[model samples]
Target: MFLSGFYGHQAAVVRGPKQPFLMETIRVDPPKKMEVRIKILYTSICHTDLRAWKGENEAQRAYPRILGHEAVGLVESVGEGVTDLKAGDHVIPIFNGECGHCPYCTTKTTNLCQTYRVNPFKSVMENDGKCRFSTKDGEPIFHFLNTSTFTEYSVLDSACVVKIDPNSPLKKTSLLSCGVSTGVGAAWNAANVQAGSSVAIFGLGALGLAASEGARARGASKIIGGDINPGKFDKGKEMGMTHFVNPKDISKPVHQISIGKGGK
Candidate 1:
């Protein structure tokens, strides 16, 4: 149940790289200044989470870390100075947050927030360089990404949480927190793909599929996707990829397929 102070909750904790995720009772501290405590209802795994779980990067191997980002949750409570969100609000966790007042956030040319950009190495609250999660014995557990949804309750900076429609399907909207956003953002924001253009995507994973979908939404004439998996071609086609190139079958460089300077 939600309360005013330390909340005891269940969490999947990993003590070491490649170690099993042990479901344990963890003590979660209440939100700090400009932070909010969330009751995570739905969380999805992304490849980025896997990489950290496997300790592929030295920084991610920070033991006893709660590693997850893509999720939808309800605000359990709000901390001091938090105005945009409150208890009972449905929200999504954003690894890269926009502070709203930052010059980058104020300008239309970029979406990055000056103070709260996505930092994989960041494992503590911005207000104070410390964690809000701890083991039953009071051993501090590090955080993963900005949104550590592996636990039942996670404390996030107010900027990292975005309020969503109360009636929205959280299971579907959960995709927006990571892979889907990464892919769509690439096509729509980074590339600024113009209509009737040819788009070539190197990978056909969830990110690639979402990118193809975004390109399709923008009226791209051709969307060419390259991947080692032949099984993914059908799904890619369904997502608006018009052509598929198997790198295993192609003997020459894939980029020589006549992409214009304007192509993404």
Candidate 2:
């Protein structure tokens, strides 16, 4: 039985790279096996999304596409053979997919699962080459990454969706699906930032600020943040950045100034 009553809805569509998004009414097919349909509640625009939109990611370009990876939504229905999740479940759609038995997934060393890999350049369901989304006249539109949350409704592989706390605030929780997680993970897991070490983050964006916070949590001796914008300094400092370096103000690289002039 289908819990989702709606079959087609309005979506922001990009016909080509560097093109403005056009609001169009599109159709979403029913979830296939191991797939789930979701009604997007909130989707945060990410820099990665912008990059894809601006045609920076030429290798991953899928025309007439919907680009979004950070989203929080409620499961409207589960497809055949889906047992772990159900209708009405609050969920976050992830770009990464885990098979649970793959070497990368089993080792816990990486989240890049081999079983459910997706070609962001190509727009089709990982299960099959067929597109689940289409124009009102039945013209196929490519799926962005794996979850096209720019649309009002979406269908995704079950492995690409994670159940979240039902009571969690959907607006803030959406950030966890992308940028926030990327920043925190880079600092804690990849960098392995140690206590009492000096940490320097190159930018004052979300990722850099998050890295500073991670370094502070690890008891770093100093956390320096470098950015061109002076307005971001205070917010950076609040997030544990000890010093702010403005590149435009100095003749040389901010690194030379922040880290000191010489080996001495």
Best by TM-score: 1
Tell me the tens digit of each residue's lDDT in model 2 across 44-93. Answer: 89887898898886777778898899999999888888999999999999
- lDDT tens digits, residues 1-264, model 1? 235656468999989989999998889998888999999999999998899999988854688889999999999998888887879999999998888887898887335677788788888889899999998788999887788999899999998999999999988888889889899989999899999978889888889999999999998988988999889989998999877788778755545553532221
How far is 112's C-alpha from truth in model 1 (Å)? 3.6
- For model 1, the local distance difference test gives 0.86
Q: What are the TM-scores, per candidate, against the unseen true structure?
A: 0.90, 0.89
Each model's backbone clash number: 0, 1
Q: What is the lDDT of residue 216 in candidate 1?
A: 94
